[model samples]
Target: MLNRLSIRSIFLPTLVGVALLASVGCQEVPVTGRNAINLVDDQDISKKAAEEFASIKKMQRASRNPAQIRIVEQIGRRLSKTVFWDVPHADWEFAVFHAPGVMNAFAMPGGKVGVFSGLIDFCENEDQLASVIAHEIAHVAARHTHEKYSQGWMLKPLGAATSIGIGTTIGGTGIYVPSVGSTAGGGVTAITQSAFDRGKELEADHIGLIYMAKAGYDPRQSLRLLQRMEEDIASKGGPTANGWLANHPSFPQRQIRINELMDEAMSHYEKGEVSRTHTVIE
Candidate 1:
């Protein structure tokens, strides 16, 4: 015989049990040992990425040199295949912008990669370029952009609406917030953004080296690339308030971390799982 109070208690517990089961049935991230909250579909990001890439191609001056474009794509394809074989139809596209002054490369979501020609001037050889590509690939594989978006969203409206779950979101779609602290207060300042950027760079380096070795590139290239970046920074005498170099860890500290991570990366290499292909850019 169940009274109204007893029935109510049983119903509440049953409802909670169903919700717990639903939440626990989410996906898991590989290697990172983290559960995922992927309410936003990967296809959505991929579609957005393809559209944005189309516009980028229209606006940006692509490298006119066929040899250079081929080399960059060749390296990019090798690295992409090595890291993301599980995702066969990833739609990875690599483009080299003819901008000589902007020594930068970014891996956008859904496998769109951009390499500014200036980065080529900075990197002396393929190994160095491999290092950059590995780092960017790490950012993609790690799903850092999605993590960032989830972090902000989970903290904002979702936190108010739902309980804080262990795996809030790994990859998801949401309106971009201008700053991590956009609604709460003033946007993340240049100083704070610099610090955050440095942290991301370090994470990228640590994970990127593993990626390089995993793809059969010598892990030591990671260290060499940091050293060269350091020298380039010194050549400028001091950091500018508004530039890529200013938005990262001081070259010295970054160099040290790169060296430290090299040994560990070498261990992963010794396992001999990575595939290798070497071809001349010219």
Candidate 2:
């Protein structure tokens, strides 16, 4: 009983409706307000991060310097108190790895932070170190990595309805792609990763300054740390010699913004009501 014209009318409208729903089903990122296209859930990312973390512990030497570990832990705790008091589930732990050649610091979801010994060489003192930890913390608080995963979920389909259900699995273990470093596979991922990564870095800079100020250190120390890091990298020839430069904003650009925010951060530091005991290390 179906004529060609009648069938065409039904098929065309159904196709358009599906297209519209497909477009609306993508997840939106927190803080940055961008839409993400991902297939994996947060539990997936968290599981992977935990597995990778365990693997790292098996392969690498954690720092033996208890004093240094305590210092870093203190900074992390103070920052958490001010910036992430709402994240009750945050199992905040700071560890110093013994890799002096690998200048790296990164935070996995759920507040697992690692700082390498090589990075300490770049920090002039606690404020500088706090800047690094604060930035990593921002990544976790803002859920930037999870946003990246959500972006991937939208573009790929296990099946339309199945994929839609997975979008709710938004946070999980950190998974890094060995070759391209966690975000090497998709069109949306590449475009948004750069923009989101850069935005998160800038947000960290701003929010980290607030943490530095609240913690009773000169937020200007953030700029100083980046300057020192740039010089250190230049002396070493290039970033390949050190892992600290692995994923970060360029020295000049980050330094410029930090400088711009210095005075405002200093005012907050001066006005902070708490009788803080944080020491400004040389």
Candidate 3:
């Protein structure tokens, strides 16, 4: 049913990609047991992320509140130390911006993280702030963005690449890969990519819960934060949340899935608390 050239185009890249993935892409997400797609190296992504993060920090009005800023850095440090780096390295910084017009936070590769003052307003306590920050860090930890860039041609399955140039899977929706360089037929690609993006957001939520729990923050607070975010988004009635909803699953769906992961996350919290309380002083 297949000839040599056809097989070469199909299986060769897949094999090479998989091999690269084994050495580079097989970064398992902490606590999620998901093996990430390796389209880029951590150092490479972190370098780029650091550049972008610096640019963003310059553009925004950084918060002057010493209290808020200190809190942000403290929480970030607590979580960052627990990161499971196959090649352990520390390059973490956390900042709080005083932009009331914005209500969000994000973490970049290289351990750079930022939170907006407006977002902090919504967070009722240190735990709630931990909820949001851990979620953003989870995105970095999972390498979601790099995996997205890597999904197109490299990940295309050999069997599917025979009929179509390359294909990718997103949220159980398998995209029909277009012929190489054919942007004209990318509508399905966009939609499928979007679905995968939403899936990544949900995955971050799950993993973030574990990170915060392990860091001695209760994961249930994240659920409360999400619940409030949902209400706020509904009230605002638009994309005022800064494209947060655009690539994310519906608020209700996120809430439901977070509810599912609650028990496991709480277990981590209980364990973490016990471990913390019993720290021996020599």
Candidate 4:
């Protein structure tokens, strides 16, 4: 559907949002306190995310498994409590959706978290599950989704302009393009997207490791989970499932970096830690 839309239609609003960013300045991400190019307001993004989350709940069937619900809620309750004071007016809700073969999960803005049964089944233990939850929560805490909106408004349209120019030069069709030109433009878009996603994945891993540790999960378990993912990728000859793993850094490289953060994350752990007990469904 979006493919049918004109490039200008997509880019113009984005250009306006970029200008708005210049006038309003940026927002600092919580925990990291890093200033991110926040073109859209955080509260607005949070509201939108909550709306989307509600829509998802409406469309998808939630898991009725008591154990699934209990485990997800327990871990979510623990991890979310750590940042409750720092995040005000936060309405945190956690749910497990029963979407067979949908290997996906997310912690949207406004603290709405959802776990897919497929992901829980795929995970060997609660540690791996926590790894996914913590990473997603870090995405929320660092405002990665908001940064993406800002980046989209500022960069994507400009990238489209560049694509048009490239198309014009190669096919003399101006903003219009031949199939070859379309392919070339898509290639540029893919490269730029991959580059941006790399940094976000690294940041999520760093922040998430700390969150999981503070929540009484072992930081080293994050590494074990990543290694398991690497094995999955190896077995499949590449990252097979889409979305989360699509642009994530190669498991080997990501695990290497996560390993470097072990000491810092482990410092938060104690000899005996309380963590949710999970028995993988399948």
lDDT by residue for model 1 (82-145), tens: 7675344567889887765455566656787777666776676776777887777666665665
Model 2 lDDT tens row, 77-121: 787776665334566777777654444566666777777665665
Q: Is candidate 1 or candidate 2 better by lDDT?
A: 1
Q: TM-scores of all models?
A: 0.70, 0.68, 0.73, 0.73
For candidate 1, what is the lDDT?
A: 0.59
Candidate 2 TM-score over all chains jointly: 0.68
Candidate 4 stretches with Cα past 4 Å from truth are 1-19, 31-33, 155-196, 240-245, 271-282
TM-score of 4: 0.73
lDDT of 2 at 91: 68
lDDT scores for all predictions? Answer: 0.59, 0.58, 0.65, 0.64
Model 4 per-residue lDDT tens digits across residues 1-282: 466467676767676667778897787766566788866576876776677667667756779998778878878888888667545656889988775444446666678887766667767777778877888778777767667656655756544432321111110001111111333333222212232377777888888888888888777877877776666656655554323355666777778888888887888765335554444544
Give residue 111's error in model 2 in angstroms. Answer: 0.6
